[model samples]
Target: MRLDKYLKVSRLIKRRTLAKQIADKGRIEVNDRTAKSATEVKVGDQITIHYGDRTVRIKVLALNLIAKKNEAQDLYQRLD
Candidate 1:
């Protein structure tokens, strides 16, 4: 899954376009390296997002093309 899409599918970001904007701003990282909107992600990869004075880390648990509100949280495990 692409980083931006993953963020949206996982409900970490509300929309795909917003996720892309955030990724484009260098506010996101994968496995400790800066990640782009199109960055490929797979199970077990770590993702970090920095916004304002907050930082969130999540471990990829699963990938889904479409996730319902109840299922979104299952896509990633919060690390912090």
Candidate 2:
């Protein structure tokens, strides 16, 4: 899946447009390298998102086109 769509579908960024904007601004990274909004993301890929002074890192566990609210968190695994 595209990085922006994955982010929204996984409920990471809440909205696809926001996710796209974030990715375009170079606030998102994959495997420690800057990632664009259209970057392909797959299972086991490491994603890091910068939010101000805080950073969120996660490993893609699964990819789904649709997921229930309670199941959204299952898409990725948080990493230190």
Candidate 3:
């Protein structure tokens, strides 16, 4: 799955557009390397996102096309 879509689907960023913008700006990383919006996300990959005043790290647990709000958290496991 695309990095941006994974973020939204996993409820990390709340919106795909915002995730895309952040990824484009080089604020996101996958497996310790800078990642683009279209970067492929795979299970077990670590994703790190730099927010304004903090950072979030998570490990991809699964990849699905859609997830309900209540089930979104199951898609990734927070690492920080």
Candidate 4:
């Protein structure tokens, strides 16, 4: 799944467009490397998102095209 899409589907960013904007600013990373909005996300990949003075880290657990609110948290495991 695309990084941006995964973020939205997982409810991490709340919206796909916001995910793209954040990625475009170079505020996101995958597996320790800076990632673009279109970067491919795979299971077990570590993702870091920088937001203001805070940062969120998570590992990809699964990928789904559509995730229900209750299932969004299951798509990724928080690492921080």
Candidate 5:
């Protein structure tokens, strides 16, 4: 799945547009390498997002194109 879509579907960023913007700005990484909005996200991949002074790291556990509010958290495992 696309990184931006994964973020939104997983409720990481709340919106696909915001996730795309952030990814395009080089603020997101996959497996420690810079990732683009269209980057492919696979199960078990680690995603690190830089949110200004704060950083969030998570491991992708599943990919769901449409997920319920409570199911969003099941898509990724927070690492930090």
Candidate 6:
């Protein structure tokens, strides 16, 4: 799935446009490299998102086109 879409569907960024903007500005990284909004996200891929002075890292556990709010957390696993 596209990185932006994955972020939204997984409830990471809350909105697709915001995710796209974040990705475009290089706030998002895949496997330690800067990632764009259209970047393909696959299972087991590590994703790091920069948020001000803090960073959030996660590993893609699954990809789904749509997911319920209750199930969104299943899409990725938080990393140290």
Per-residue lDDT for 1-80 in model 6, tens only? 99999999999999999999999999999999999999999999999999999999999999999999999999999996
* Per-residue alpha-carbon lDDT of candidate 2 for residues 1-80, written as tens digits (9 for 90 to 100): 99999999899899999999999999999999999999999999999999999999999999999988999999999996
After TM-score superposition, what is the CA distance of residue 67 in candidate 5 from its true location, in Å? 0.5
Root-mean-square deviation per candidate: 0.6, 0.6, 0.5, 0.4, 0.4, 0.5
Find the 10 residues in a row with the least total lDDT in model 6.
Answer: 71-80
Specify the poorest-scoring 10-residue window by lDDT in model 3: 71-80
> Where in model 1 is the C-alpha error above 4 Å?
none
Clashes of 5: 0
TM-score for each model: 0.97, 0.97, 0.97, 0.98, 0.98, 0.98
lDDT of each structure? 0.95, 0.96, 0.96, 0.98, 0.98, 0.97
Tens digit of per-residue lDDT, candidate 5, span 1-80: 99999999999998999999999999999999999999999999999999999999999999988999999999999998
Clashing residue pairs, backbone N/CA/C < 3 A, model 5: none
- Spell out the clash pairs found in candidate 2: none
Off by over 4 Å in 4: none
lDDT of 4 by residue, 40-76 (tens): 9999999999999999999999999999999999999
Error of 3 at 77 (Å): 0.6
Q: Candidate 3: which stretches are off by over 4 Å?
A: none
Distance from true position, residue 9, model 6, in Å?
0.3
lDDT for predicted candidate 5 compared with the true structure: 0.98
Candidate 1 residue-wise lDDT at 79: 96
Candidate 5 wrong stretches, greater than 4 Å: none
